[model samples]
Target: MRLFYPRGSDHEVTRLVRSDAAAVATLHREDFARPWTTTEFDELLRQNTVFGFAARVIGQPKAPLAGFVLARLAADEAEVLTIAVARAARRLGLGRALMEALLRRLHALRAETLFLEVDETNDPAVHLYRRLGFVEVARRPGYYGGGSEGKSDALVMRLDLGKAPVSR
Candidate 1:
């Protein structure tokens, strides 16, 4: 799947390509406590059940790779592996754009629900997911590690796509 913005628009989302490995790795490293290597990302791209995407500003150099979202489909469920926006790109709707794109793809794949685990202390991401209709369903203690604050709890959130309200 693909999403495009008119020329000179703020951001654009596109299907993940092998050529995106370097930029993606850079974004992930800067955004996550533990980032995936290019080879690891390549392996993920090779998986039949995985889908990935990248977001970029219209005229940015080096793509900046503002953000990316990854998910794996199983039966009727899709689990978001990770979604991260660069520090410089937060609050610009790149994360939301990537998520909307991912949701559209999951809908196309006939997914009934989406699940993810976010750091309990990540107020910004938690707010975004909640705004997107994801509800906290469970918690995993000490799910995140090696941050400035040490280990943090993980909140498992779910979005029931099967029953999601449709916009008029």
Candidate 2:
């Protein structure tokens, strides 16, 4: 997947590797309240069913990653663990591209379903998933955050990879 920005950018997506842990962690920290540690990323990459990829811009120093997606597969079912794009890279097609790439992988693996959880307050994320053919199948009240920040509901969305709409 080319560095999947919505527009005004051209980059490519590369298979996520153990070496990408730091960059992934950095991005996760900036965007997520509970970010995965570098060690965690390393461990996930070691799992046979876990898969991820990093999007990077061309000619950039050290090729800083612009976005990423991670997921796992098991017994015809898969779950999207996370997908994120840098703040500077938002509104680009990176998120969609990541989903498309993951969908391709799931399809190749014979996965029948893909599930993900999104904060109900994340309009962009919810919209993106809906656009990608995911449907709300369940919901968890106060599933995210803790303490003073208050809890947020998580919408459990499902996409039947076998029936996913073709990317345009």
Candidate 3:
């Protein structure tokens, strides 16, 4: 199990595994409207194309995760499926660390590009992606429902792996 600390963070980034399904599912429910189930997470974790990272407090390996990121890689492309941090853990750099870990793994795998769709109204997530060098590529109107303003547009963002991330 490869585990490392992201610079300036107290959390450890570790390889996500099948047993993490239940914990990640619980975390997912905190942020998503229609959260994925543990069974769904299990299936995804079993897939060869899917991989992810989980963040946990240093020295507390058995404790609940602070955050996680799930992604799928096919050929030279990768797409983030979902990412979530516990409400209590927000602003502690867990989300950014999970995403950065994914990026580093994708780079090592020689992935050419990465893509993700985020709710346009999610300012924090949008800003995080922008800081990571992701740019808007397209949009899907009413892609998500039941937001404060009813439905919301989804912003499709892309990052070319050849370029360095924008310095924060």
Which residue pairs show collisions in model 3? none
**Higher-scoring candidate on lDDT, 1 or 2:** 2
Model 3 C-alpha lDDT per residue in residues 77-164, reported as the tens digit of each score: 9999999888888887878888988998898888999999999989989988999899999999999886466998999999998884
Ranking by TM-score: 3, 2, 1
Off by over 4 Å in 1: 6-9, 59-62, 146-148, 165-168
Tell me, what's the RMSD of every candidate?
A: 2.7, 2.3, 2.2
Which is the better candidate, 2 or 3, if ranked by TM-score? 3
How do all models score by TM-score? 0.88, 0.91, 0.93
Residue 27's lDDT within candidate 2 is: 93
Question: Per-residue error at 126 for model 2, in Å?
Answer: 0.6
Q: Compared to the true structure, candidate 3 yields what TM-score?
A: 0.93
- Number of colliding residue pairs in each model: 0, 7, 0
Structure candidate 2, residue pairs in collision: 2-11, 3-11, 3-12, 4-94, 5-93, 6-92, 6-93
Give the per-residue lDDT of model 1 (tens digit) for 1-168.
347652344878888877777777877887676789988888888889988878877666465787888889989999999888888878877777778788878887788999999989989999989888999999999988865779988999999986554321
Residue range with the least summed lDDT across 10 consecutive positions in model 2: 1-10
The number of the candidate with the highest TM-score is 3
Better of 2 and 3 by lDDT: 3
